[model samples]
Target: MVCRVSGILLAVASAAAVGGCGGEGGPTSPPPPGPPPPPPGPTIGASLNLRPGEVHVLSERDAIRAFEIQGAAEGREYQVIVMSASLSEGRTTPLRVRARADDVSPNVVPNARTNRSGRDAAIPPARGLAGELRPDRDWHLRQMIETERELRRLRARPAEGIGRASRGLAAAVSDVPRVGDTLTVRSAIVPGGGVQCTANTPIKSTVRTVGEHFIIVEDDRLAGRFTEEDYADLDRELDEFIAPVSHEYFGEPDDLDGNQRVIAFFTGEVNRLSEPESGSVVIGFHWIGNLFERENCPASNEAEIVWLIGPDPDAEFGIEIGVDFVKRVARSLVAHEYQHLLNASQRLGGQRGQDTWGNADLWINEGLSHVAEEVTGFYRQGLRVRGNYGYTELIAGDPDLVAFRDFFEGNLENAREYLSATTEFNPLALNNNTLDFATRGWGYVFVRWFGDRYGPAGPGGIVAGSGEAALYRELAVGGPGYLFGYENFLRAAEVVAGETTTWGDVLAEHFAASAADDAHEALPDGAQFSTWNWPRLWEELRTAGVRGLTGGDPLRRRIIQMGAGVSSTDEFDLGSSTARYYHLRAAGGHPSMIVETTIASGGNVPNSAEARIIVVRTR
Candidate 1:
């Protein structure tokens, strides 16, 4: 039977099922197949297009704020993405997302009965692990991030020792301290709470191997043992692959230690800072203070240094670092932390006064470092083979994705967490005083998206700087004033997108892409992610779903799948700088959708709630 509800037509089995947009339009339908494979559906109503950053402000008198999204008037298919983010500079407010049919009939899907919220917002249940993650690990991570932030915030300078060192001390060519030689290097008197110490940390260290770019040093008092061959292999990986890759994308490192080579100092103190037994552990680190003059910290080594958790053959420090650990993760550490080393050097080297590297612009720095991790993996796999990134193996259900995942796994894991992270935290809207793992995760996601969009074109696919790296390089060098979050993007964006682009437009599209990642079109000029094949990658992650980070399927991200019926989420608080997503779609019954976003049970939204509703069609 054909019935008309509120002016839209619906094909229903019976007139009794008829209901308004406020009620369940009809009955229930089977859960859709899931993403990575979005089946086509019937064409519904009129084709509607909206300008980017379209704002639909809810008034104090309005009961509910609703927008109508209809299908194409012709043959093209599409979906809808609705994003609600708090514009408040610093606050979290309540938000509710819902969808239902109104002008159309109830019997949308021929066999199925109801409407669907459209995507999955839930994750899989938990799986217990032998080792539980520790809370202090996050504390330690935040500590290190804050320490670097302060150094940059303070606009620190090269140590007095570094600037006034004797000719031989600062020289880059002499081999006064060759391989097998020992030296007493001044190290940090490490402490908690981002504190800087003037004295109290130094260790006797022996050089194991020397590469073109870095010298591998092990503490003489270290417990972890290694062979000459292992040291040689470490030297090769650092000098040949890691060093070259880090240099190419991020620029250069300041030559410290008087040998034209930075020091990869492996020490047990790093281990001492980590969890005693299992959980989130700090394996390695690079202190920004190393670049300053001795007066900055009388004990400043004044050398380009990256510190790693030296090996512990015995479970002496509650964690064991074996030869296998060195072979796998320790090398990867070079790939990760080296970016921090270079970023600080290039940004602060010649000194642009205090305006430059001092800001630390957390998100971009972390994002670029993470990108460095994945890009190096891509380089190792062979220049830039687009689809070659974990596709075939992931789809084939290959258990071991050894090669690429090694470099990119942290990115995928953290991104999953970011999507499932607490609503109170927004990646871009971060606090200078605090930091989190998932926030770091979003940094990776954003940078990856930025590269795919703004990065120069590559050979196989849109690689991160195939010939000459553009925005990524610009971001590292930064502008005259570098603030955290979007401001950094705004400045660098002009380098590629020209002047007129605004933050509202970027935020809207980012939220839109966060939801409707598939249909790159249907969106305005700025809404697109040309690089990654997310669905395929998502499908691969269905199994080894992160236990603690994402208890359910990480793919669930922000998708709220309301079947062929009316659907709504429990009122959730929307935090500043954070975005909340709701996806809606009609059933087989070719009907128009009415998506309502409002305060669940309120008189009206607050005036200070600088709210912007960005809707995009993702067919």
Candidate 2:
């Protein structure tokens, strides 16, 4: 008898099936209701109408596509030149493509780079500086990148463990470190001038607040001067927010020393590493050696550890870490380094991408760290800049706003820099450790933009796992759904925006959204950030120059001045993961302009430096 049957006599019910698939012969229980029949797929013939510069991706491969290049007016002028391009790694065979005039057009206007335009104009780093990290700003990333390579290179030798303390070996991994336990750590000279993360420098740590997720350790002597609550605040932020946020988005950390928690070694030693007059501030950093087995890598503690500069008001060392973390600088670095730890840990545990270090691509990794900082900012105190305010009022008052500005300014400011010179920076270049503000900010913008679309985007681009855990987890651990690196990015984007999304689509639209103007308005649809009006915010920040960081400018003023259809064109070298923008408008009285696109060459557009234009018409 099925349980669904109305009340039955106890005797019969006992003899028959009670509930789901009961034992003994019984009326065949219906196979557990199969999953609701798959949703009906979309109807067949899909049509897309693109405007003068609007883009539509041809879904089918090696299949012909149709375009009716219609013009309502006789003088409707538009440049429609399509050249075959590939974001793929290899060269393309000579394929059939039809574009007008094989050579540069006489009417074509020579477009210089945004940075190259003027002095007030933002200058891009020279071509040689293409993929380099910012000078002295990121010692941690530089050190770790080389450290991983050196360790792997050294791994070819047989039986290479730094050895155990039980055997009286050097820098051995100890048993689970407990509160109040002091441990000797093998560290390195701060990477200002000398060798980086060499493990020769030694620092003593006294375990302070050992939380469930983080073991807060302080430098033995001076660091203990900070109140226990001060130390515990670091642990609390990591436990309640930072660590969990990182673990959610980038996966968990490694427990190489059987601690099952991250050792956040806060010391003044790190802060003092900064050379005087250089103005470089070294924040928290998780040494990559901690991930390696001590037996394999001599410098390794074989445990997860992030070293941070501690509070020193006098600047006896260099930069002050500041005591009140919840109110100041240290809080941000906690989230920053924590993300690095999780990302590296995730890749170390079988999710490695194309980088030589077997970690996630640097742009992706750095971007996440930057986003991690801002998201933590939102989570910690909530974003203070909710709407566009006049530059004068915003700077003049609001203490909470000022604290928020100081804390949440780096990524925001860097992204503004990225916007000023979007054409030069390649968001996907992984060839070297050229991890500057532009590249790093590009990643941050990508993640923020993607999360705004796919993830549970809340106010100001904060993607919270509270609503949906899937996107966060999928991002952290590369799966069959999203392999890794650039491939991972493309597929995951398809999951939200539809599978028709491609590198070209991403480049074109991203260029539009980030341009901070009606350029996005002129593009297809859904090109700008779903939340956050960047143009207004940047405009406010720029008008108030007081918000600018010491070395960096607040934001560059937009240099280009545009007018109605003057009939002009420009050539571009569209490299892999880079894009450029063009404006095509109808003549002063004409109704509209139509652009037809196609590729005509044995073209390898990835590095082809070929000419392509994406028109952003002014309304």
Candidate 3:
């Protein structure tokens, strides 16, 4: 009986299933058909003006994309990403946009319809669904969108809109790295009042307050190393050197604290404080590491000057390193380092606090520092001006014969030495020993020559021009056509000459002349060379007719164009045997030549001496 009932129930269930297929009473009748195909995908009758909306979404296909659909208006940039998309098959949503995201830019097409005639409509708006959304990495897309929108709002004039947008973005993202930041290293001592690091390595230390602008952390055990009077005098000398002198040259105050204080660490390990292989007895050195940038370190604007004392054999006894000698050396070191600080801090190519030694030829920076020693009178202290073995003293003797002869010879020798170095470094390149022979020796001579030949307004014009009164304007960049090279210096020389002149021509002419030439002879059957001191040679050149002397042939009038590459000759009668002046201008951009008559006859007679004037281009 149970088996018969089971068969009947099965038959009845199969019949009901068949009826349900054709009946409206079925439990799963097709989902009440989702609201009429979303009104034929809402016609894009007007321009698809999108406006700002709360909901944003990011969808990536080929490239990342971010946008908002609701209320998206024309000419308005949107930052929000799209959260949902209501796209349809056989129908296209007109995505009119000039969009850029990462490396992808898609062009917008106008009048693109969601469907063709008689084709299926777009998916319903209510059917919009969310897909992968990445708002974090969408800034690039937003930036492009903003940039484009701003451009469009300005009537597609990209010059104004795009430029401003780009600058804004750059400014927002750019940051000054801490690559050369400096901290105030106040005087400190470790626990147990241990020794401070100095030339005297193991001496107990006491951080002594050495007044404003400096602190002397001295070795307590070597209290007698330097006297209180010595410190005071040294301090006074330093102040004098920096104020109204070094400060005037750089056109800025010393790079010091508001109180003008600096720290001085006197130690026994002279070699430890100085550069490697810098000899065993180092007088002093400035820490260049504090000026240059390190891999992950910031540099300091001011350099801490270190002095090696009582350790160097020469510095210990009052022999070659007498008290006066020590004082002079210390002051000179201060001046040298201060100039370096100026170079590193002064503006170069629109950049400030840059390493000038790295940017400019090392010879220039080092030469400038060496020149600073004389210009600031650090080398003159404790001795007569002429007694010091400085640039000024080196220029002693007649300005015409001895001084200029010495100058040229020095320049040639130093140049040859530098070029012949086995290291194969360019003469203009900077290095550890750059200042030793060439820079400090010949380089200083050139600097002095520039200053003396041009007066305060000439090539050495840098001295007066680069003063605090001038606001320390960068003469090298904006003030004039000055560059950091010998060629540029020649340009300044011409400017000082008040006519088109080239130093190259002058130098070449000198090189061709015999050492014993009568033209440059001071006395003994020669013209009166300028009576001015050698330090004032530029002033004399400014006033004199001829800039240089050539061959001893006194009869042949040699017209030397310091910066020319051609040659010519002319003959004229000396209407009077007495001196007659003539200004000769020639081709090849040669300077306006100033010629004074040289006659074989001594009397004032219009003699047909057939005076011949030869013009030569030196360079």
Give per-model TM-scores: 0.76, 0.68, 0.39
lDDT of 1: 0.56
Error of 1 at 31 (Å): 53
Alpha-carbon shift of residue 132 in model 3 (angstroms): 81
Off by over 4 Å in 3: 1-223, 253-265, 269-280, 292-295, 298-325, 348-350, 353-359, 378-426, 429-435, 457-483, 487-619
Q: After superposition, how far is residue 604 of candidate 3 from its true place, in Å?
A: 45
All predictions: root-mean-square deviation over Cα?
A: 11.4, 21.9, 36.4
Q: Write the per-residue lDDT of candidate 2 for residues 1-619, one digit (tens) a residue.
A: 0011122233322233355545677555544543553432112112222453354433232111212222233333232223223454322322222111212232232332223222233433322111111224545556666766766766621121224332211233355566777778766554554334345567777888778888877787565458877777667877887766566556676555666677777777776666656645555577666666545556656567777767676666665434653235556766877777776565565533323234446667777787777666555554332222233333344555643453356676567556555445554444444555666667777776665555533332233332223454555555553356766666665653355565566555555555433234554444556435665555555555433432233233222212323222233333445543333334433422222222232222223533233333323
lDDT of 3 by residue, 180-199 (tens): 22223312112322112111
Q: Per model, state how many residue pairs clash.
A: 30, 12, 32
TM-score winner: 1
Error of 3 at 48 (Å): 88
Candidate 2 lDDT (Cα, whole model)? 0.50
State the C-alpha lDDT per candidate.
Answer: 0.56, 0.50, 0.30
Cα lDDT of model 1 by residue, 1-619, tens digit: 1121232444534233443444565555544543452332222222234332332222212213445454333322233433334444557666555555444342232222212222233543222111232223254345556655655555455543334553222343354457867766676645532335354376888888878888888888772477788789888877767777777677788764556788888887676665564455566767777776555455566678887777777856556756555456666677778888888776656463444554345666777887777777766655452342334443243255444345755666667656655454555455644465566577787777766665544542223334335666667777555444566677777775455465655656665556555554445434545445565456545544533433333433334342334444445666655665555443343445555555645324454555566555454
